[model samples]
Target: MGDGKSSPNPSSDGEEEVRREMPAKKKVVVVMGATGAGKSKLAIDLASYLPCPIEIVNADSMQVYQGLDVLTNKVPLSERQGVPHHLLGTVAASEEFTSKDFRDLAIAIIDDILARDRVPVIVGGTNYYIQALVSPFLVDDVVDDITACSLNSSRELKSVDSCAGYERLKEIDPVAANRIHPNDHRKINRYLSLYESSGVPPSSLFQGEAAKKWGRADCLRYDCCFIWVDAALPVLDRFVDQRVDCMIAGGLLNEVHEIYKPNADYTRGLRQAIGVREFEEFFRYYFSNTMADGTCVCGNCSAYNSEDGTPSSINEYEEALEPNFLEILNSNDNNLKVLLCESIDKLKANTRKLVRRQKRRLNQLKKYFGWDLHNVDATEALLSMPCCLL
Candidate 1:
């Protein structure tokens, strides 16, 4: 998230005025894909071909939080090309934002856009947020209590033993525990909330008819069409690799350090975003020369060095990190390079996992909510989705 209030494209004011004069289309087009697959570009380009003026509604959960702009991959305002965008970098990073919160706010935003007679194009990689908007699967009837439980859990989890909450979740909902990673605090908290609010575990609830029942007919709020920006796995892998390199080059570490609050648990709020947690080890290395969580391993070696700044090259990193290399019997420049390379490799690995999860969710959309997705090859330039889709 960034510091200031979110801005609309200043160049689009005149066109937006004209758009307000037209009749409401009351229609929606949703763009979904893995990160770095050009979902934002597709949304911006798709707006141009639509007969009615289309305003973008962001569905990406990370981008909704303010600051960490580069890590979140916020579409540069210049790239917006005079199209109005909503909900980009609107929440502070310290705040807790959830899919249900997005769904309610998006509903109101869509209504406002419809009243102004403009089209709303929903774009983001967060399929969960999109699902909340298009389906009643997470209706307020259920979410209100869940939200209360979440607040209670947030408070309770902090004071009690950390593992206690996770253990309780496993004891009550082992099926959910099996599905969720032990380290994933967000899912643990959510599963616990579900148990607390509903007095039923997710495994049984998921198997119930109510959870299984969802369709287009249930979406009485607005008509929806989903466009999936598709790319081959090899192509996506290349894109992800290039994107990871760019993010690191663009000072993603600095950004992470700036917003990172120590002791911030991933189970609550925006800290769970990939870069913030992934760079924990790197940040420790940067701030404290010793790799051992601020503990100096060497008894006689000086722990502090003037070369504590961000290293531009492997040589610089090697020189700055020498003190921390005392543990290695025959530490050399090559050894330090290998350690640094491991950090980058870890970042790339985490990013690939995120991309795979996103694609898996996209594949399961139809199965979960009966959403028929139109596929678009994003690598092709000058491509346009069929505007006739409603």
Candidate 2:
């Protein structure tokens, strides 16, 4: 009887060991919210709560690029509380890091973390990045290699007239044409490019099971827990404005100044960052009018050459002008001052609008994709947290 009981115990222990060895579904935590909602802080704080180690994969499109740290609002290393952050400021500033790029890179990172028995915390305000990561379906997935390069090339699309592009899309895929606004040249171009590239109708990608389930919760590539750190619109708006002001105080101008170019493409790369383009007019005017000696060439300002003497060469003058650019903000020139003020105002306004748009998109994701988002209201925290904490 004792021998038989010991044999049964051995079998039970083997079953338990097998159960322990079985692979569990990988879990990923996504912390998403509007800009300035403390998503970074919350994601870092999660490390203390979870049983496993956590690594962060940044999903912010702009934050992926190197430089412009203040303008992009990237979480500083010290503020990260020693959490290993992946894909943060890793891309070249000149390169366009698209949603597809993010999805591919982030999945690899998340999988590696899971393989090591750690959770990946994806934190960012970029909704499309988050969507692409969790959903397997992407527009690029359908495109073949031959024409894929031309799919979203603004230069290639620019050559095609908007009306003609829409007409071409209508001819190739009328269902797609009717779904998008006629004036939405970008989408029109995308559809036409998709059809031309893959030799398939753009509308066909969404059919039957694919149409019903693509990007929905049932199609999620991984088990995900979504945390949306939200706040009241009024409170969020106020916080965003304050944050912008803080950013400016913290060397945002100098950062933007370093990247300013005469005809930089604002549609791509780090130049697409909000504060960069807004300051274009101010920088253009500043560089064009200010002399090497820091004298304003504008008719309204007095012409006072540098005490060190005017630069003998145009290049030398150009090099000397930058040091005095900030001082020009305090100069008596009303136009320069107005331009600077307007740019700052525009940055604030645009950021506020982005907050609303992000909130709406988050709501749409929940309503349409059946995302079970856990909302944590940070209104009180935003209202009460000191500037240093924020």
Candidate 3:
């Protein structure tokens, strides 16, 4: 993420001479929301209130890619107000950011902050990204085999990509295939290692509804007090529209263009976060001097939904003033849910609710995302939840 390492610990001579001090560690606070929800803004403001200098551990999915200052709506440096942020714009376009990578990196940053008596505030709207930091979701290689990993390099295994991994998982553990993120190479490789080393699939071992790891209801640790910002859907949609407008106005197009020209790894890989694909449409459809709207004309676009937009990014994004975004947004995840925006407002509302609910559950579990699930969704109502959201 952010290559910004915490500076070396200063000699305690000056401060230590004054008083005997207790070893105090950093406390972490996470601000979470959905796309278009105000997460970074809140995190930035909250930094000023921490007991020590805040080292922001960014958890947004898109912000890690370098040079994407505008498209991912990279938090402006001025807005940071000088509070040092970790992991905002660090990785190049060619590199990939994985949850396991995030976990290892974050633990280091958090520990560094604690050693320096600072607070670490982890913030972002990407739910999974935040979970990677605070949760107990283990990503260890299949305990059954140690030699398997040693035999293969991470790049060699990861090169298989999620597609091949998914196919393999289906043969080994079909149930897990349904749940694992299609793009999650880490998990896939882990599963692949399991199959290659051990004879059975991981899902078969965890083959029960009681398998809490696969459950979606879990999120936060058991001791967290959760608060969620609530707003009506229509209002949030308006906010999303305005936010996207601001990104476009703030030179997001240029940032995307710069990255696109480089054809770097991140640009083609993770940089496809959100708006990058939309602008690709703009480049194609109105490449010449055509005074038209710079909106996505993909399949779901009102224009494509109405008639004109096409699929090819080079054609739709490059030629037009507005990139054809409908097709890009309408793409689906493994569950067939559209990866793109259905409604910005609904996305903001539901995802925020999801985060709030997760934090509440985590507080109950006593470990972030570590809870005893009896494997029933409706059963959640039976437990008396703490009064924190108010």
Model 1 weakest lDDT span, ten residues long = 381-390
- Give candidate 1's whole-model lDDT: 0.67
1-390: candidate 2 lDDT, tens digit per residue: 655546646678788898799666568999999988889888999989999889999988889999999999888988888899999999999886777789999988998998898889999988877887898776556543434465443334456766688788888788767544444444566667666655668788677776776679867887889999999999988888888878877889878877777776666678878899889998887766664445544323233345643444534523433344455467787888899899999999988988887888899789878999999999989999854455
On lDDT, the leading prediction is: 2
Task: Estimate every model's Cα lDDT from 0 to 1.
Answer: 0.67, 0.78, 0.52
Q: Candidate 1 clashing pairs? A: 1-65, 1-66, 1-67, 2-66, 2-67
Candidate 2 vs candidate 3, TM-score winner? 2
lDDT of 3 by residue, 1-390 (tens): 259765366565556754466433234666554454455665677666655677778876668767666656676776678888888788776676776677788888878876788777777655556555655554342332443445442323535644666788887778766544454565667677766655555666444542455323343332232333333444444455555555544655556654453232322345546555444433433322122332333322232212332334543333334443333434542211232233333334444454444434334433433433222121122122211100
**Candidates ranked, most accurate by TM-score first:** 2, 1, 3
Stretches of candidate 2 exceeding 4 Å from the true structure: 1-24, 145-155, 159-189, 195-204, 291-329
Candidate number with greatest TM-score: 2
Residue 212 shift from truth in candidate 3, angstroms: 6.7
The better candidate by TM-score, 1 or 3, is 1
Which scores greater on lDDT, model 1 or model 2? Answer: 2
TM-score of predicted structure 3: 0.56
> Where does candidate 3 stray beyond 4 Å?
1-26, 143-182, 185-230, 261-268, 281-390
Instruction: Judge candidate 3 against the unseen true structure and give its global Cα lDDT, from 0 to 1.
Output: 0.52
